[model samples]
Each structure stands twice: as C-alpha cells, then as structure tokens.
Target chain A: MDNLNVLDIFKALSNETRLNILRWLREPEKNFPAQQAHLPKEVSIEGGVCVGDIQEKVNLSQSTVSHYLSLMQKAGLLEAVRYGQWTYYRRNEETLAKITKFINEEI
Target chain B: MDNLNVLDIFKALSNETRLNILRWLREPEKNFPAQQAHLPKEVSIEGGVCVGDIQEKVNLSQSTVSHYLSLMQKAGLLEAVRYGQWTYYRRNEETLAKITKFINEEI
Candidate 1:
C-alpha cells in the first residue's frame, strides 16, 4: 500500500455496485446483521463479512462479487482475510485515510 | 453541486490522463507555464487556463480533451467558463472539498 495509485483506486470505485459495497462495509454491523446472525461465533471478525455474505447482500453471482472484492483489495481499499475456506473482507482504514489525504492535498 | 455522486466522481477519475489533468491543474502556473507566457493579460483569469492551452500540454486531440473536460465539469470536479471564443477551465475547489469530505466521512 506504499504507492497507492489514484487511477487504480478510481477504477476500482467506478462501478456503482462496488461503491455501494464499500459504503456497506463501513457499517458492517448495521448493514450485514442477517449474515452476522447465522455466522458461527468462532468465524466472525469485527468489521469483516464473509464473501458469501457479501454476495448474498449484493445479490450478485459469487464470481462477480469475488471479482469486485479482488479488485478492491488490489486497490488497497479493502483487506481480505481467509479464515478456513471462507474469505472475509473489511475496509482498510489506513489506506482509506491515505486516499482521503491524497484527495485533500494531491488531487 | 448539491448532490455530488461518488460513482460519477470515480468515473471521471478512472483514466490516467484525466487523473494527470486534474493533478496538473492543481499547479497550473508551474505545469502550464509555456501556455501562460503568450496569453494576453486581458484574457487571464486567476487559476484559469484555456481549453486549447490544456490540450496542447496534454498532447490529445482538441475533441478528446474537450470530452474529458466536459465529463470532469459534469462531475463537478472542474469549472468551465467561456471567455470570448475560448473556454477556460479551473479546478472547482468547492466541489473538490465536498468530495474529500465524502471520502472521509461517508465512504
């Protein structure tokens, strides 16, 4: 995340669904309550939601959601952690803060 | 610029050239010094540069640059003002500040 490229970030965010997904991740507890209810306590990570849960919420195919999440992760906008067979994604606040700084001071 | 859409802002910034154009506009006097040298004093607006001058520096065809500028203007990232026959472009700081706030708080 050292050299975060603006074009990559922008490209990752260009899609409306991707933007909504990022915003939803901001308040996971509120936005993903249903998913949280069924998740085993052992598998849960604060602010992190499983890929299946995200796909369910977005109503997109698993592959599509995975692709979007991968793009976001590549852009340093989201961090993905694999717990067993499932991948959980959470917003990368450090990178997000850097992006805000970039917007304020750079472009 | 009441309802600044995040998706639109991201779309406007998705291209490398457009991103560079926005960054270059940040320090127009330094980046576009050659264009400034020959401009008539009467046509100068603080922080504003003509479309032709911007196109020359970008090395893009006039229409392509205009399309990019128009898209940026529509997204509220830029302001376009017509001066006689030439259109002047400048960063819309107010909208830019709003976008930064959106990134920091909303997203």
Candidate 2:
C-alpha cells in the first residue's frame, strides 16, 4: 500500500498483543499447537496459523485475538484464510518488506 | 530500550504528524528555517531542532507539538534537550537502530 495507509498499519501494530501475534506467526510450527486431525496435503501450515491456535499461545480471550487478527488483516500486515469455522492468519511478507523499505527511505 | 517498550515507540510513531516530525528532523537544516541567532559553538543544530521550529514546519499548535515530542521522547524514539527557554528535539539514532535491529530479528 501507499504511505498514507501505512499509518493504519502502524496503528494496527501499536498494540502489544497484536504485535506479538504478528511476531509469533513468524514461526508458526514452533509457536502453534499440532493439529491432531488429518491435514490436507495442499493446505500448508506455512500459509497461516488458526485463530484458536493463536489464542492458546497468547493467553487472550478468543474474541480479543479474533479482533486483533482482523485489524492486522485490515492493515495488510496479516492475511486471513478461513477453513470451515477456523480462521488462519499469517504475516504478509511482501507488505512487511514494503514497510521496511519505506522506513529505510522515509525514516 | 527493552522489547516491551518498543510497543510504545510504535504507538508514538503511529501518527502521521509525529512520524513526519521525526523524519524531517533527520535533515533539520534542510527542513527548517535558518536559525539567525548568534551561535554558541557548543550549541549544535545537529543535536536537535527547537519545538517552535518543529511547530512551524508541522503547522501544529505549540501544545500539540510539545505533547507529541514528549511522547516520542518517552518512547525512546526521540531525544530532547533544554537550551535556554526552548526545548530541542531530535531522533535518537541508537534507539532507532536498536528498533531496526529488533524488527529485523523479531519480524
């Protein structure tokens, strides 16, 4: 996104829990619990971690985590994928890189 | 600064005006009007720009600019010094570098 909306991304990241969620999502395998159920061969865990899994790690209410994930997604900091009732969220690396580059130039 | 307080830095930086103030401070001579007053050799413009000068550049009220500067300073994103009656503010390079390093390692 452009510089203007980048402010929104910064706003999304200002919260501690939300920032931690994004940082935690960086290493999904290490951070999230194992799914006992059969996994789809095509649905890679690398794509994202489910909301339930994230809440378990953060010690936050499900609703709070859900709200943070939604805000992060809205800011283009994270991407959300829904599989049934579970919503998986992960950082959008491209956007993160864009922010890094923008900071390098602008800051 | 510790990892926990980096969140405060992000919060301080979330606003456009605050971020712009920090960015503009990076090149103070270019961004602000020339200080025509008699120089104190020890008083380096490199150290910081005055709050009044920042207010002019940002088109913000004195209190608003002062408040933002205090927040940024509290966050460790900026440093402030008192020069006579004026308080001068500038980016804290070491803190900024620490944050950049943190983001590189964490995000």
Best-performing candidate as measured by lDDT: 1
Candidate 1, residue A71: the lDDT equals 95
Query: How close to the true structure is residue A51 of candidate 1, measured as C-alpha lDDT?
Result: 87
- Top candidate on TM-score is 1
User: Which regions in candidate 1 have their CA more than 4 angstroms from the true location?
Assistant: A34-44, B34-43
Instruction: Please give the distance, in angstroms, between residue A87's alpha carbon in candidate 2 and its true position after superposition.
Output: 1.9
Give candidate 2's whole-model lDDT: 0.79
Local distance difference test, per candidate?
0.85, 0.79
TM-score of each: 0.91, 0.88
For DockQ, the strongest prediction is 1
lDDT of 2 by residue, A1-107 (tens): 36437788889878888888888888777777785233477766465888878888889898888888888888889998777777778889878877777676777
| TM-scores of chain A in all candidate models | 0.88, 0.86
Tens-digit lDDT track of model 1 for A1-107: 34997788889988988888899999987888665554578757778888888998899898999999999999999999877787889999988899888888788
Candidate 1, B-chain TM: 0.88
The positional error of residue B20 in candidate 2, measured at the CA in angstroms, is: 0.9
